[model samples]
Target chain A: MRTTHVGSYPKIPDLPAPGRWRTAAEKLQRGEITREEFRRVEDEVTREAIADQVGAGLDMVTDGQIRWEDPQTYFARRMDGFSIDGLQRWFDTNVYYRQPVAQGRVAWREPVTVEDYRFARSHSPRPVRPVVTGPYTLARLSQNRYYPRFSDFVLDVAQALNRELRALDAESPPLIQVDEPAILQHKEDLALFREAAAALLEGVRAPVALYTYFGDARGVVRVFYELPVEVVGLDFVAGVRNWEVLESEGFPQDRRLGFGVVDARNTRLETVDEVLRALDRVSRFVPLDRVDLGPTAGLEFLPRRAAKAKLVRIAEVKRAALEVTR
Target chain B: MNGLPLFPTTTVGSFPKPPYLLEARRKRLRGQIEPEQLRQLEEQATREWIQRQEELGLDVFVDGEMYRGDMVAYFADEMEGFAIAGLVRSYGNRYYPKPVVVGPVGRRRPITVEWFRFAQSLTGKPVKGMLTGPYTIAEWSFNEYYPTRRELVLELARAIHEEAVDLERAGARFIQIDEPAIHTRPDEDFDLAREAMEIVTDGLSAYTITHVCYGDVPRIYPRMLDLPVHQIDLALKNEDFALLEVFRQHRFTKDIGLGVIDAHSHRVETAEEVLDGIRRSLEVFEPRQVYVSPDCGLKTRTIDETVGKLAAMVEGARRAREELGAG
Candidate 1:
């Protein structure tokens, strides 16, 4: 059995003088602090984030995407041809993401996630998986003013992201995660997603995992299974009906499956037994070794304390499941 | 119905914050500035916004919500039995303290009354007293206090009712209860939404208006007309005038706030585009029953874009008034 976080740990508290990433960003904006100084704090926070995950005894670790303000806008601001405009409420959540407006041809100017991933890889004792917001999601979330057709936009973003993924792939990380939560929203575009995902994962040396959540991906799971990736992550908590899809499709024994047992969207703490029970249900589809346990989505919605506790619960649930197997 | 001007122009509350105001807000948040100092800055910002709207020839105006922060959090913080949670990202770079309903929700004192007084003092034109609607407050908040969602929503409704009545008592003629969250999840129980709106606007002497943005207005229609407000402000420009067909298809008796300018975009709307939107809306609604406004709050926009959009909206409304021969 393996343990890991999907992405985004809660904002690390800057106690004594409390502050969050927004606070730091505000300071940077006001010229009260410099970009170099802001980055120094981010590095400090990122190190603590990795340590928190390590302390929880995760096998496949992620950088927690602590620096990403939110998934879509973070990348939107970095990429060419994407201008982030007003804030749009992120789905039904209280959270929001700056609505990305594609005014021109989407192009990758530089490696957006490589340095952050390298920093995380250097700090972690365990194998680190760098996560990127999937191209399909970027296309879905953005208001495309340039593209005549939506598929053209998705694939264009895919090509742009392909450049970044290839750069990260050069380092040969153990795994790379492409988050496509928007796939559930755009099931009609599955055929297009296949092309986009293939292009995104092409020429990449590392194992690629495509993850989806926020809705049931059961209808789209078969399409995801067909994609060029080593692992498929599903939201078992939110997509409770996903179990039926797994039973019908039957898990590919050779491939990996990420079981999202923890509910990251809500603040409620899932009991260890509850997680163990979900894992038991997951076992029916795939063997324990093939399974990766984590949150249904990023833990950004949770407070720092609750997010940490959930990590501890995941560790505890994994140990309990492992002991039972032994 | 009340003989309001043909193609009346108003804002959907908030205007763009000038850089100095944003800086002042950041300083206030950091505890570098005192509460009085922050209030002075807010007052200054509010005055500037009111003056701008008057200059733009808007028939009605807003204080631009300068004294407020997040719409829900601002009210939640002031109310009893509500606790403010940590800053959660509401959108890219923008954050709001999620309100957690931990106990019985009620108003101990006036929330927006004093702010309305200050804003009304600034402008002879009627300023809308803005409040977050009960359904949105209940929806946006983490509810732990009430037994059911209905109960929680009703409790919030009662609290808002208090604020609305107080605003009326404070000599404000227009009060807008914003319910931006209602249309987001259209599948959810809307009876609770209607019940809550009825409670909030019950017996209000003020011209009751409700603004719902970034949602599918057509999905909630006809039933949405059942909302107890005198006016319904829909983000028509963002919906790309799609809801105009819905309005035409259905019998919409009440006044409609036609959002001719897209508030979400930073682009300055051309007066022609705004005029086109107004003309389309005029086809569906009587000119006297249509209020030309921005699709949503302009807080997210830059000052120049906001000013330009409002100017276009007013100019478009003026053109519509001339075409309708209502002058």
Candidate 2:
């Protein structure tokens, strides 16, 4: 079994004096630090974030998205014709994001996430996966004043994000992950989401993983199987109803299953024995070779220390699961 | 409810933070400025919002929550046995420090009363004392110390009761307890949240109001009626006046804070649109029971949009009053 994480690792604590990238970004806004200084800090923290996952014994890794203010708005800020405005609540969570406001025609001006992925690759011996905020999620979370229809906005975002995906694919990472947390909430728009998602994954050379969390995806799990992706990740921790889908053989047998057993939102630690048991239940339906064990969502909700500890246990559990299957 | 006008116009809570005030907050965070400097800035923002509400001819006004950072975190910072956690995602990319209950939750001092006094001192018009309800605080936070969610919420309820009573003693005639979290998990936790809310508002002498925003109200009704509040405020306009049917079906006995303005949108509601919403709500609620307001807090909107929306709301309420033949 392979070990991986959903995406975000908790921010590396600034020991001695405590702060994160948010504090640094504030300083940059106030002109207290030069652009060069800010980039240096971002690069330094990104390295620490990567090390957090790599040191925890993971086969595939991410840059921990340290520089991102939030998943959606960070990309929105970097893209053209999209402005970050107003802190809208992210789903029902206490965290907020600057709502991505579509001001004009959406287009990709330059690479948004490629450089960060390259930075992570340069530092780590393990393969670093590039995680992009999926087009459907970006469209759903945004305030679309310019688009005539919501689908028009989703398509434009798909076209824009496709360029970023192709750029990252040029580097030939083992996998490219597109996060679609909004898909679980919009089951009625499954047909629309599939079209938008297909547009996003088109012409990508690397294997694509479409990840969903924050709610159950059992209602629309069948829709994801038909999409042109190699991996489908479901949050078993939050999406408890997904187990029935698994039992009913709803998951596609041809693709890799990122089976999430660890609860990322809560701080409690899951023991290796417990995680192995969950994997055993998953192994009944899916082949062990096609299964990747990981957390239900990003680990940002927990403290850095707690998140790291969770990953360490997950890695140990993955090893134990592999031994059992072998 | 006494001496209130027919279809009284007010805000749920909060107004937009201008660019300067946002900068001041950042400065205060970096220790570049003193707390006194930040207080001066907050005072200036509060005065501007109060003056704007007065100019717009609003019946009940709020201080716009100029001194608060996040709704739940602000109270947690003031209370004992609660510590602010690292930034957790509430939605999209907007983050707030989730409060962690480390010990018994209790109020050490008054949080919003002084700010209430300052804003009430400025205007002859009554300013509603706004607070984040205990259920919302307990729901949004991560409790490590408490044994059960119900216990923690009730503990938070006791702390919040202290703040509500303090606001009353500070001469606040109208107090709005914001419980935006009640909209989530209605099937399992609705009764628990309602019970906690009753604990917060029980025995309060002020004219009590509860604002539940960005939610489906019809699902939580009957249970919502048991909140022990004098008024139940909801974002009716955002629902496109669908809540009128609920009000009509259930027959609201208490006052209704009808939200006629959409706070999440950049498009300012025309006075006609606001008037239509108020008229539709009046079909279900009595004119004396109607309190016209926005769907939620105005903090997410631009300052210009906030002012324009409030002006339109007041104008619409005036039109509704004229049409109904009630002054």
Candidate 3:
């Protein structure tokens, strides 16, 4: 089994002093430092994040999303026809994201995350997966003033993001992850999500993983499997009902399973036996080799130390699973 | 209520602590300073904030919540059956030690009453007793003990009920229980929030207020009025008072703590802007039904920003009252 991060590692390292990234960000806001100077500090932290993932023995890693303010604004700020607005709570967590307001038909201006992916790929020994906040989630989370219908807005966002995905695909990364945690909240939007997903992955040549978290995707699991993606990631911790759905309906053998066994939202670490038990159950349908073990959601919800420890635990689980299989 | 002005001005609790107090808090956390030393500084900061409010000509006052950290964690730290956990992100570049409920939760004693009494003693104006609502405490915490959220919330409601009663006994005229997490899951959890609030506000003599900010306000608009409180404080300025349209559609049933200044922005609002906000609010709410305040807590802003925002808010309220011929 391979181990990987869903997306987003903690920005701050386990340090006594305030993190340099935070300090530099404040300095940049205050005009005390140039944008170039602040970006250098961000680059340093990005390197550290990739190193952290590599040190934990993950097969695939990311840039840790250290430079991102939050998932929504990171893409919304870069794209056209959107304005970043006030802070809104992100799901049930204590964390908040700046809500994106769509003023007109959304369109992709240029590649947003390609350079970051290149930076991560250059710095890491492990394969780096470029993660994009999915169009369905972007449309769901945003306030739309331009579109007459919600479907129109979502499809437009999907068409816009398809360009970004094509750009990332050109990099020839291991896999691309599209996060649509908002889908589980609105199950009826599956058809619309399918339309958007189709548009988003239209010309992308790289293998893609569609990941959902924060809640169960039992209602949309079948629809999720129907998508033209190589992998389907679901949260087994917060989205426990996905387990029941998996046991009853069974997973498609053709698609790889992104087994999210680690709880990224909570500080509690899972033991090897606990992870092994879950692996045994999931391995019934999807073979162990075809599964990617990782946390349920982004590790940004956790402290740096706990997030690192969780990563180490996932690596340990992978080793233990290998031993059990042997 | 009769003693208040036409457009009564107040804060939604929490002002930015001075640099020395922030340093003292840090020292106290590292065990470099005694509890009494920290308490003294907290008192000093509270006194200064109360004096500042009086000078700014606000009708009502809050103790500024200088002795607290995260609103949920503060009560969790004082109450039984809770252990503070590792850092969790609250927002952009903001983290707080999340509280985990480990056992049967109970309040050993009044959490904010002593702070309320201290602040009240320093001022002649009525100081609002501030407490984080039970729904918020339960929603924000990691519950390991309670089988259901309702049970834990009700237990917390009972615990906060004790605190509210004590604050009323200590001569608090207004008690603001903040439930910022109420609107997070409006479909499933809103009723539970109202039930828990009823348990806290039942038979309490103090004018009750619930402060909710930065969530799906439109989703829970008229239904939020079902919350058993005398007033609902909202972050209206940040949303450009767009909620007024909803209020106009479904008549607002309770007093509104009209947010006239944006608390999160570093740029201080002009008095004209604040006045414009107050004027827009008056279109939907009567002057007496409106209470002027900042959008939310001022702890996120610097001391200068907080002062500038509040000064502008007070000036705008003054101008609004004059226009209404009630100054």
Candidate 4:
């Protein structure tokens, strides 16, 4: 079995005086540093985030999404027909993200995350996966002023992100992951999400991961089979019902599984024995070879040290799973 | 409560700490200063804020929470069964020491009563006794000891209830229990939040207010009215009073701490803009039910911005009262 992270890793490392990145951000805001200077600081931390994931023995890694301000505004600020507004709490967490307001017809101006994806690919020793916030989540979380119908807004965002995906596809990344954690909360919009997902994955040749977190995907798990994606990722920690659903109704055999076993939100460490037991149970339904061990969600909810440690635990679990399969 | 005028103005709770107080807090962390020295500075800062609010012509006052850090962490540091964890990111470029519940949580002493008494002594106006709600304290913290979320939340509610009773005894007429995390899991945990609130304000004599901000307000509305409190304080200005649309559908039964100023913006709102927000709120709520305030706490802003925003809020409320011929 292989291992990978959901998406973000902490930008700041665990250090006694790791105030350089924060100071640089403050300076950029205060007009004390150039935009290029701020980019240099972001690049430095991005390299550190990549190194941490690589050192933890992951099969594939991301840029750690260190450059992202938050999941929504990072892409929203770069796209056309959108403006950043006041802060809103992101789901149930203590963390907040700046709300995005769609002012006009949402369209792709240029490649938003392609440069960051290329940067991660060039810096990492392992193959890097490009992660993007899914269209359904973008539409749900944002304030839509232009589109009278929510489906139009969601599809517009999907088509816009499809252009970005095609740009990243040119880079020939290992895989593309689209996070739609918001779908877990609004299950009635499954048909809308399916349409948006098809639009998002249209021309991309790379294998795509449709991942959901922050809650159970039990309501929308059946629809995952119908979506045009290679892997279906579900959170098993906060959304423990996903496991119950997996037992009652097995996942599709044609699709690979992103086995999210580690608790990403909490700092608690999982033992190898405990993970092996969960892996053993999951192996009954899906083949262990078709699974990728990962955290329940992005590791950004944790501190740098705990996030790194969780990555290491995943690697350890993967090694034990391989031995058990052997 | 009957002595207050219509459109009475107040703040959510905290104000920005002065530069000197911030430095003193840092020094105290590093053991360069004693607890007593830090307490003296905190008292001074609290007094300065009290005087500033009085000068700003606000009808009610807050202690400014000058002695506190993260709302959850401050209480966790004093309560039993909690251990402070390392820094976790709360949002963009902001981090806090998240509390980890290691055992059964309970309060040994009355937290915030001493500060409430001290701030009340300085102000003739009723100083609000600010306490983070039990649901928020449990929600924001990492729980390891409790078998279930409800157990931890209820235990926290009992502990916070004790503090609320102490504040009422300490001559605080307004007790603001902030449950900013209330709407986080509105579908599953909202009823639990209401249940925990019932334990908190069961028989409290003070005019209780619960401040919930910056989430899906539309989902929790009408249902949020069921929360057992005298007032439901909300951050409405940042959302541009979009929540008023929900209130139009269901009549707001309780007094509303109407947020008329955007607390997050660096550009101070014009008095006209704040007056418009108050006017919008008054459309749905009675003039007496409307208590003018900022969207949330002013701690995230600079001192200048905080003062500017609150000043505009007061001016706008004064205009609103005049428009109603209640001044």
DockQ for all candidate structures vs. native: 0.30, 0.22, 0.49, 0.59
Deviation (Å) of B157 in candidate 1: 3.4
Name the TM-score of candidate 3: 0.92
Give me the displacement of residue B34 in model 4, in angstroms: 2.5
Assess candidate 2 and give its lDDT: 0.84
lDDT tens string, model 1, B144-202? 56757788888889989988999999998899999988876666667788888999999
Work out how many backbone clashes candidate 2 has: 15
Which residue pairs clash in candidate 3? none
Candidate 2 CAPRI category: incorrect
Compose the digit string of candidate 3's lDDT tens values, residues B15-72: 9999999999989979999999999999999889988888888888999999999898
lDDT tens readout by residue for model 3, A275-316: 999999998889988999999988987778879999999999
CAPRI rating of model 1: acceptable
Better of 3 and 4 by TM-score: 4
Selected candidate, larger DockQ, 1 vs 4: 4
Overall lDDT per candidate, in order of appearance: 0.83, 0.84, 0.89, 0.89
The DockQ ranking, best first, is 4, 3, 1, 2
Question: After TM-score superposition, what is the CA distance of residue B190 in candidate 2 from its true location, in Å?
Answer: 4.7
Docking class of 3: medium
The sequence of per-residue lDDT tens digits that candidate 1 reaches over residues A1-326 is 78988898766452333665667778998999998988987887888788888998777677878788778878888899999876666766767777899999999989999999989989889888899999998889889999999989999899999998999989898888999988887688889888999899888888898898877776778878877788899888667778888878888767889888788865557778878888888788898888888888888776666677778888989899878888
lDDT of 3 at A253: 85
Model 4 scores a TM of 0.96
lDDT string for model 2 (A303-324, tens) is 6776888889888987787687
Task: Indicate which candidate wins on TM-score.
Answer: 4
Q: Model 1 residue B263 lDDT?
A: 82
Clash list (residue pairs), candidate 1: A96-B90, A96-B91, A97-B91, A98-B92
By the DockQ metric, which is better: model 3 or model 4? 4
